[model samples]
Target: MEYSTKETSEKYSNITSLWRANSSSSSVIDAETSPVHVGPQNSLKENDKIEKLFGQPEGVDFKQYSGYVTVDPIAGRALFYYFVESPQDSASKPLVLWLNGGPGCSSLGGGAFGELGPFRVNKDGTLHSNQFSWISEANIIFLESPAGVGFSYTNTSSDYNFSGDSTTARDSYTFLVNWLERFPEYKASDFYLTGESYAGHYVPQLAQLILVHNNHPKKTIISTINLKGLAIGNAYVDFESNMKGTTEYYWSHALISDELYNKIISTCNFSTPSSASKKCNAYLDQIDEEIGNIFLYNIYAPLCNNRSLSSTSISEVDPCLPSYIQSYFNVPEVQKAMHANVTNLPYPWESCNSTLNLSWKDRPLTVLPLLHQLMKSGLRIWLYSGDMDVVVPVTDTRYAIKKLKLPVKTAWHPWYLQGEVGGYVEEYENLTLLTIRGAGHFVPTYQPNRALAFFSHFLSGKLLPKE
Candidate 1:
């Protein structure tokens, strides 16, 4: 999620590194508590059930893909999406669900653009080829979760105002069930729930929910869960870590003066900080002017900075900022692939370009509780952060993990990719936290090669090398 004039909430690499913490945090073994109850898997019966619940795709095309749709059978009127990359043969592969967070943002931005989708954007705002895509390495699915996000519309356009983390998780889980019927091969594949930003909550809760249901006699049954792991870049897992990390990252980078840093640290008790909505609002207000004057999202834009583009210069294109959103969304190929009619929408796909008309009033911290439930059920959980993002910094993710209170399984260590330092890693009970170097909120867009290497390590159920 990107920030704009409006009020709302804003705010990954693949198989290269398997990081191990320096110290042991806790044990990964646990007893099952809650039981997952998924009824029969009669394909015909399930398909009929979902169709009855959610209508067929509006103008969206699934010809290239094979999957079923589950309408807002539970929510007011939100569509649930589940895509599959089935095995060429009958063998089963791991199933991974990808989510991008914007409170009101669509997964298509992150899930499709930054991570597993097969394409990327060029500096000129044109779509380009992505050769190191994650989906190529594993079976990946992207979702337009909750209602009113992406193509997933609702009867309540007002539903935009009704969002919270818990509601999102619950709705997401419901979508998972109906989605499973659409592609049953994944029902037994090692399941891994993953996402970024607010997804800090989405991935954990969804995983825990699956664990709970699996423990039940009638609910769904999952294999080892391969629970294998998950990775987050600049995740907002913990509020304290998030805020403090933001100031810290800026301060360390010399963006803030020592005096100002001291004042911020002394004034803000990250452990139990007050709402900086007013103060943060003021600060952003100042930054807003600068952002416009510079015609850049961050303080620095090499592409925008250079009068001429050199072959060696970083593509002047900054993929993560909101300013390029309109042009990015308007790409003919993108519109065609997403089944989006860019002209008809009232707002931009990115929240940064415009005020946030959508409401995060519905979001709640539901994933923490769900994480506890999963840990009790012997599920493996992992959380990661990309160090460069301010929206959902590493600090926030650290804070979120602290809340877990699980014993430390491994101590902090640097995770490396191809022998180069990638990020830091920590282990606790069944959970792991990782940080990717030089990657922002959208890890793939920033470092696709690293993302690919990371996912490669993860799917193999191995720990990345520590260098």
Candidate 2:
């Protein structure tokens, strides 16, 4: 349910006031306090450089860097990032900032290690090269945002209570500004924002902030981000669309009975789910029971059979990868190598922080308006979904896009990859919507080749093969 009401707005203001008042004393250099023009410096960049990860495979050619970028010095807040340069022609590749959204997930664990980064962690905690890593197409930075996620943290313990969409966007924007200072060579490189799941909120919000900064009257080059576009996979864009699409999808896919579907439709209000009647809640509970123990992220994919072992196939999805990632990052040696956990956070590293997720204060009913603003600014926007995912199903995304009321530039058609149908695509005037046929919520994990195909197309600004 969305917390967009006047009461919620007042709560948000109170929280923000408290945060600012508490943080007013600290003297830290962040995006807000940094100089307007930043120059390339070899020192800080060199310090953050990962000479090698603990279990990284040998013969690695690309440079990797991981460290914390302070966003709020007053709160001692910082965000951790893992950056991998393209193995070849690193200087020429565009910089892609990837975020993974749980509102509280670790992008380092989800994006960098589990999905599109250069390496995948093994059951034994060793790293192996991912043949279809997106690093081949762009310099990727996987950020663990909002201070409470992954190794990112704030000195002020109470800051966790105030975490929400606005703070995340602001901190992330600050991260980019400070990160650019640390790696100024990429100041002129084209930048793109990419994320999946809840980053539906993160990617667009951050992009909007960058655009605002770029247009500021007294903005300097350093403060002016070179944001070009963004793409989100299986994104949670609108609550109403998502709710309707989910129930409809479950019914259409035969995951629920016709009677239950009708009950939900008639009893529940998608737009105001927080006010759902007890009968509606009971019906929702029944629907969940009917769906059973299957993995909702990918209904057809098997549950983690061997949580102790990691799959080595590039073409196959590993359901247990998250467990393996958790194991790998918690290793003291790994943390030392990546320059993470410097403050020795009391909690063990988790892929998604349930506490923080539960504490999320303000989520809009829809981000379609922010997206429209970005499109008006002429940024390339693409929304792709994995047909197998029930969490943010293809149907829901389609419903959300329909709400935009955009003029269709291209009708739906099958797009091919390697002589096979990869998925279908439809081009609107300012946005593109596509799907990965057999992939799940984490598209890259389930269909790496197809994901890479579309990612490369996006970076190159080329149309998908219509064969």
Candidate 3:
């Protein structure tokens, strides 16, 4: 019997659920007790306004907007989005579309609130300004893509039951078309697709769609979306390399025993796991025992043991912060302020949609071909990895990129920011591979200041400064 990708993922979902399913509270406050108003339903363009924020965040200069763009009216499927203008320049900055990957995660929650967004969620379910928000250099848009993820949803229940890569990419492309129509002022904006994790698939696929539409605008009912480039961090580009690299990463880092590592590495290839010998599965099981209860995403980063606020590191955002994010989005006032969960969602918001089971039907194992096409078309392509991320470690990314066999344009060198070495960089014909030193899976959250410097330079077309 052939199992679907969703079925395959289901088998492993529980193992990966620790970080994702931190806390999902149905903490919606009684709206009757606390008035949360979004004024009238007859607002202007969906993309041009924010209903309101729960409370004003101090020192925040950029305007904020959040709402939904209807992708298919007949299906009643809409995508939720949060837009923030550049803090200083409203009119001149390029627009960046940011995505986060679970294959089914909320970009608004992860990217906008957790990583490089202007605001961070406080434990008290309040908002605070992130000094290093990516909006400093560009107009940023965070999308909760494909109905059933975050606030994006469909009236047709089957929409949630059936969704894949093609559905996702097609819907995202449609969302952009409708969004551009609503926010026409940004029609000619220099747009770039940015994301991390599975968005390695999302960015390239969406970029490909936009590129095709730009060439045949008349075919698309909407005008051309000016897609210029793409940047993805710790991206999932190749399946075999990622799986192989992650196992090796654990062994090399002393998380697994030498005997077990040797046995598994020699016997097991994830590419054909079903055909594995009995010894391979036996060793793999032993490897899992060695990896028990540790934070696999960032090998060096400490986990929040004791679950206390005091255990948090002041330098990086708290590991328990995703719980804060989930709780904040649960607040009735906050949801109303952002015009989210308007129909009163039956379930609380989560960082990753466990409710979704895309099974890999729409997923492409490798987006390398798309990346190659984009690079040849002269689009600036960047693949950055946080060196500390074991989940999608830099080793796998390096291996994946090396397969391109593109001649290097610049030798690998240290890139500096704030008078210190920030990371390392190597440039190819049209592609740049960068590594954020000491950063984890979520690079922006772990290294905010350095991440800002990295992104600001990328957006400005400045090469990473060799120090």
How would you encode candidate 2's per-residue C-alpha lDDT over 1-467 as one tens digit per residue? Answer: 11111122122111112122211211111224334323344587788999899899889999999988888776788889999999999899999999998778888888898888999888778988999999999999999988888899999999988798877888888889889888888989999999997888888888877877787767656546788899999988777777788778889999999999999889887665556677877777686568766776777988776443457877766667777788989999999999989988998887777667667776666788888878899899999998988777898899999999999989999999889999999999989999999998888888989999999998777669999
Looking at model 2, the pairs that clash are none
**TM, every model:** 0.72, 0.91, 0.88
lDDT top scorer: 2
RMSD of 1: 8.8
TM-score of 3: 0.88
lDDT for each residue of candidate 3 in 362-400, tens digit (9 for 90 to 100): 445466767888888878888998887777878879878
Q: In candidate 3, which residue ranges exceed 4 Å CA deviation?
A: 1-43, 46-48, 273-278, 305-307, 310-314, 358-360
Per-residue error (Å), model 1, residue 290: 10
The window of 10 residues in a row where model 3 has the poorest summed lDDT is 28-37
Q: What is the lDDT of residue 164 in candidate 2?
A: 80
Pitting candidate 2 against candidate 3, the one with the higher TM-score is 2
Residue 422 alpha-carbon offset, candidate 3, angstroms: 0.9
Q: Which parts of model 2 have CA positions greater than 4 angstroms off?
A: 1-42, 306-309
Candidate lDDT (C-alpha), each: 0.52, 0.80, 0.73
State in Å the error of residue 460, model 2: 1.9
